[model samples]
Target: MTEYGRQPVERQLPTEEARDLIALVRELADREIRPHTAEEEAAGHFPRPLFTLLSESGLLGLPYPEEFGGGEQPYEVYLQVLEELAAARLTVGLGVSVHTLACHALANFGTKEQRAEHLPAMLGGGLLGAYCLSEPASGSDAASLRTRAERDGDTWTVNGTKAWITHGGVADFYTLIARTGADGPRGITAFLVPGDAAGLSAAAPERKMGMNGSPTAQLHFDGVRISDDRRLGDEGQGFTVALSALDAGRLGIAACAIGVAQAALDEALAYTAERRQFGRPISDFQGLRFMLADMATQIEAGRALYLEAARRRDNGLAYSKQAAMAKLFCTDAAMRITTDAVQLLGGYGYTVDFPVERLMREAKVLQIVEGTNQIQRMVIGRHLVGPESR
Candidate 1:
């Protein structure tokens, strides 16, 4: 029986490829990450060697093309890898997801020359990336951003501060969006900003309630100059690129959410079986059994939602609405399930002595990142009304 009051569903298992990826990720997690999770979180520092190990293992660029030293894995297979990583450590899962988000621009919009020049380094080594779309004035409403990028002969000078950038100071490169035309979304353009560019800097990392191991900071781009070759797609196509990248990014977050929930469930199951209440194992209580059943049900549904979206994406079918739905449903489910997992732990869950509390905190961020759940709902609602009305 699944713990945390969840009943087992029909057992919708992963494909053979997904199972293989999951097995590999589990081995990596157990061998390299799980032991240091507490130390890393307490110190609010990321483990650089972890990323280097991932790069060496060919896991950092799992979803990219093989020509760039990536595994060229399908989205279905890639997401399971994310789920396993997240189940072990949220910081690592999010780090990989954020890197993949930054990579989307180069993969989908970069010129062939740009791809040849950057993809190898970005996909290999210890290189990391940040996606700079959110600004101080534009969190949920990204189109209202005030950052500007002006053309100067052969160079573009970028002037703006991007808010809540992951790997802000430490990234090797950034996929930056700035205003190159007018005032709205249509006027924006994407640029590949190397982290070593002059005039580029970051604020000290934000002190947050959770996920401390993943640094979050504000990025400053003050008159940072880039050649025309850095522009991603056309001058007016940044919005398209950003939105498209987000669709794929959302799936990554959903997978991460499931992984987090699974970890919580795993811990809860182990704890309850060993933990006794009223002189009996709490896992034997019908109330706790029901709760575990519900948690498992929700996780399965969340997994199904993301997998369906990934399937559509893989088939070259329209998946914007489905992607938003998956992200919204899955993250929201994670918040609920992880919270209940802590509740079921009954006091121990509220403390650092157990992992459920950390899982609960990690779950909250899922609802806010990769486009807030509110934004996801709006995207889904808009699509439901058809594109003509808006």
Candidate 2:
């Protein structure tokens, strides 16, 4: 089988430890992920064992605190690890990202007892998690989500459906948001619900264009019961928790986008260097050379943008706008770079035999997930000019 491996990326690390972490991640990706990506993706088989291995290796919680079984790495370092994994396979990379997002609320806002009780297993004890926020009627308008929870005698019963949930059926836990009181964002609350909780069931995974190895499904909660101790923060705080997670989650998506873009650029470079036309390598053609240069430039720019945002996050600066910009730009760049890769490979790029076509399909989803690029623009605009007048 042809190798669809990524070229090594030159990263700027803050410390020797970080450098070693990236090296370890790349080694693991090469050994465990890249080799099986094509076949598993083709079969639409989720690699549950690989996730277990990642959990054991401590790669599943790089950005969280170490006291609770996390690696305690900075956002900058954690995101680079994500890029490396994503370059190997989007399923693994994005799966890690979503898991981290799922852990955000509890790690950041839960009581000390709450964190001690759950975070270790969730982070590194081989448990996978899913984030639940979007609903069928609410995507960009997350505050309008209709999922509700009612509290009675220290027990909360949750009943609603969460849609577009990554790792839906397979996750061991879910960080869920539900309306607990009023009608809007102010009425919502966050909860940590076990995947196997009574009345919690996942629909069949959605048939998707790419990343088939990762499941996306709708979760139905019919009287799913949880103790009040499972609530992450005060009632009316779910939206705040959700938005905070999303800011960091957007950076994760940005990094994954650049990783996919870098992979596509590498494929194009490798293909162009080999394919001959008019008795010369097509890479020698100025037109294709310019295209490759443009692709590389865009990927580099996207990487830098996300890294800048990550730095801000690591420094406790406000980065919501930067994160939105990074998500908007990097995912769009990934789509363009992957499409160009297909064009570079010509007919072969369109065939299943080549990875570029799969890369292209995968790139399309990055633009829509996390937050659509259109929503991203609105986010950035809101930061610049304030909320739009109703």
Leading candidate by TM-score: 2
* Deviating ranges (above 4 Å) for candidate 1: 1-18, 387-390
Candidate 1 TM-score over all chains jointly: 0.95
Residue 162 in model 2: lDDT:
96
lDDT of 1 at 22: 64
CA lDDT of every candidate: 0.87, 0.94
Task: Give a tens-digit lDDT track for model 2, residues 111-142.
Answer: 99999999999999999999999999999999
Tell me how far the alpha carbon of residue 103 in candidate 2 is from the true structure, in angstroms, after superposition.
Answer: 0.2
What TM-score goes with each of the models? 0.95, 0.99
Give the per-residue lDDT of model 1 (tens digit) for 60-127: 88889988767788787788788878887899998999999999999989988999899888888678
